[model samples]
Target: MTESAFRCLACGDGHSVAVHKAVADYFLPTGIRVDYVRCAACGMVQQYPVPTDVGPFYAAYPVHARKSLLQEVTRRILLSPVYYDVASLRRDQLLLDYGCGDGWFLDRAKRRVSAAYGYEPTAMQASRVAERVGVQVFHDVAALRAPLAGRVDVITMHFVLEHLTDLSGTFALLADLLKPGGTLHAVIPNLDNVEYRGFGSRWHGFDAPRHICFPNADQLKPVLDPLGLRLASDRFVPFPNTLAASLSILFTGRYRLLPFLAFLPLAIVWARLYPRGTRALTFVKHEN
Candidate 1:
């Protein structure tokens, strides 16, 4: 391990423990092993040697995978901003979906908000999503920031915070993009999940280099406070894909539909009982 990866990006802790080594690239089998390190001070988990050329790693990403009508309907309902009420959005409001991914949410959001913009870092995918969803999708962060800074009423980042390398910078940039009293809804993987203790390296939340960090609300308090981003509220929410993936790893190394279906009810019940899984954290910008 080197100095860069050894130090915790979340809390600037210099010491960490290598929790999981030789972690496979589960999404695409890119043949690159990612080592997991946990900060002793913050208890935040992150990938060692954080991925730089993650493009190759995301080549076979499943966000674009075709789904059955039932799957699509359920996904739309469960993952939609409408599901979480996205800061109690209204038809007069403007919203931004950072790393919006295929614009499914944006499609749903159009009926509820005055304007919906998306920022997908992948240019090709952004084009396709823009064409498919008929929304202003910006591939460049500078382009996204230039026009919308301090103007957007609401922003949503779904399982996106974990994929970035720069923690403080990303938060600051997102905070800067918000209108005064605007809200940011972030869906993050909960590191405190009981499954994390049972699965360790096999936990789907720690998706190797693809997911740079896990839920670190405690560690991030210092980072968000100065930015005027207040933690309005947060709650445990189960992402079916996350549960299915974890259940798959529990059964085999990959997805198994029958077993996944069989155990899903139990998993949902367990998630409710323990109440630590995917977290929907809402942060509101101060009105000053």
Candidate 2:
């Protein structure tokens, strides 16, 4: 691994050591090589030498992608079963979906809660949710001050944490927004899982430069500790959808196979055995 000067994204208190080198998928044509690193002080992991072209990375997300039929199937099969179990959601609770691309989850969440809203930095994406789902979608955290302060019961970040450039600041803000005893449900790739271990640099979850930091529970603890959030419970979902896709890329360097086929048997196995610590995870804040 090539060495580069780096600091922890969360605590900013570590010497970052180079872990691996890989090409990024976010800025496609550029094909920039990024050096992945692990923080010595806090154990937080991330990529160094990120490209200046950061705006295009998130802008590429298609508005309403979640509303598509395939995404709907995956959402039901992958997300609802593992992360969105109804027991955690209660009536009269206010729910917020951070980085809620097109408000699909926001729409579904409204069914179980008194109010549901979404926050997306992308204007075009947020507008699509506003027009299609009819749920309130704010441009950023600042915009939600009036409606969200001390009111949200549960905050959900589905597949969104991996893309953030400000990990600690975001969670700190989340702590302030949540009501006492509020739950923060986040689903991101676990860097310490078996799949990630076996695949090494080729893991599909890497998603290259776009995935700025991939942390396990140990690495994540330091980031969440200051916010008074604790890991109430954690589970892993080893759905093959992403594993198959990553393996395909490792072998052929192209992902042309149908997305459903990639996840079918894996989803079945995931449904049966219910692997925890790879595909999905959840956490709740401590009411101090």
Which number leads on TM-score?
Answer: 1
Q: Estimate each model's TM-score.
A: 0.91, 0.86
Task: Find the 10 residues in a row with the least total lDDT in model 2.
Answer: 23-32
List pairs with backbone clashes in candidate 1.
none
For model 1, how does the per-residue alpha-carbon lDDT over 13-129 read when each residue is reduced to its tens digit?
778887787888654557778777888988888887766677876876777554679878767655653244644679888899888887777777877888999888888888988
Which residues of candidate 2, in runs, are more than 4 Å off? 1-5, 26-30, 50-53, 62-71, 259-263, 266-281
Instruction: List pairs with backbone clashes in candidate 2.
Output: 236-275, 236-276, 236-277
TM-score of 2: 0.86
Cα deviation of 284 in candidate 1 (Å)?
A: 0.8
lDDT of 1 at 47: 80
